[model samples]
Target: MITQVQVKGLMFDPYNNAYIVILRDDEQSEMLPIWVGKSEASSISLALENVAPPRPMTHDFMKSYLDAFDAKVISVVITDLNENTYFAKIHLTYVDSEYTVDARPSDAIALALRSHAPIFASESVIRKQSSEELDQWLENLKPEDFGKLDS
Candidate 1:
């Protein structure tokens, strides 16, 4: 089973040289972190800050393209964790056909937020990582948490 979540915040992971996507569920008081690339982090930050890009970024273009086809991103599922890697799928619905696309958790999450789609994580992944780890990681972050990524 997959549990729906929300992006609680974004933080840098010095060990991985990448960003961490934080997902939270207040009802259950749980949190999960998935490491993501710099580019994907930038895309998510831009959307969170409501920054208007001079040109449509890849994710924006994707949203527009999907909209044109009347396709809606239903949800994003972080389905697996293997050898320290996280996997995800974007569930899309278009007319009569439902499409599932394999994607990195980072990219899937950024697009999901833009498309107003709920984020999900497989029970296995959550069990492997544990919410306590997330709590500790979040507690250690400071105000100057995520610095700007170099373009």
Candidate 2:
């Protein structure tokens, strides 16, 4: 089973020296935190802020390629978590056919945001992320800890 989710916010993990993109369900109840590199976080943050760079970024280029081919991003699904890594798929429709492309969760999410595609996460992935360490980290987050896009 998969549950639809949205990009809730972006935060910094000082300990890991990485940025985290938080995906939240409609009720804002369930959340999945995926740690990503600074560059990836910047790409996603720009999309979330609706800011278009003077030059197209990698994700923008991908979207443009799909647009040129008249393809549409149907959705992006966070499908699995293994070895402390998360996996995702980008579902697309083109020329009356559909295709699923394997992608990193961060990249898939950035494209989804740019393409106006919905995001989802498999139940098993969610369950796998429900670790006590994650719980503690989440509980420790303050309101100001999020939206650290520029930093």
RMSD of each predicted structure: 5.0, 5.2
Backbone clashes in each candidate structure, one number apiece?
0, 0
**For candidate 2, what is the TM-score?**
0.87
In terms of lDDT, model 1 sits at 0.81
Query: Which lDDT tens digits does candidate 1 get at residues 24-136?
Result: 76566677777677888889988878787899788998899999989999999989987667889999999999999999888788889898898998888888778887677
Mark the regions of model 2 whose C-alpha exceeds 4 Å error after superposition. 131-133, 137-151
Name the best candidate (by TM-score): 2
TM-score, each model?
Answer: 0.83, 0.87
Task: Please give, for residues 34-106, the per-residue lDDT of candidate 2 as tens digits.
Answer: 9788888989999999999999999999999999999999999999987667889999999999999999998
**How far out, in Å, is residue 7 in model 2?**
0.4
Query: Mind sharing the TM-score for model 1?
Result: 0.83
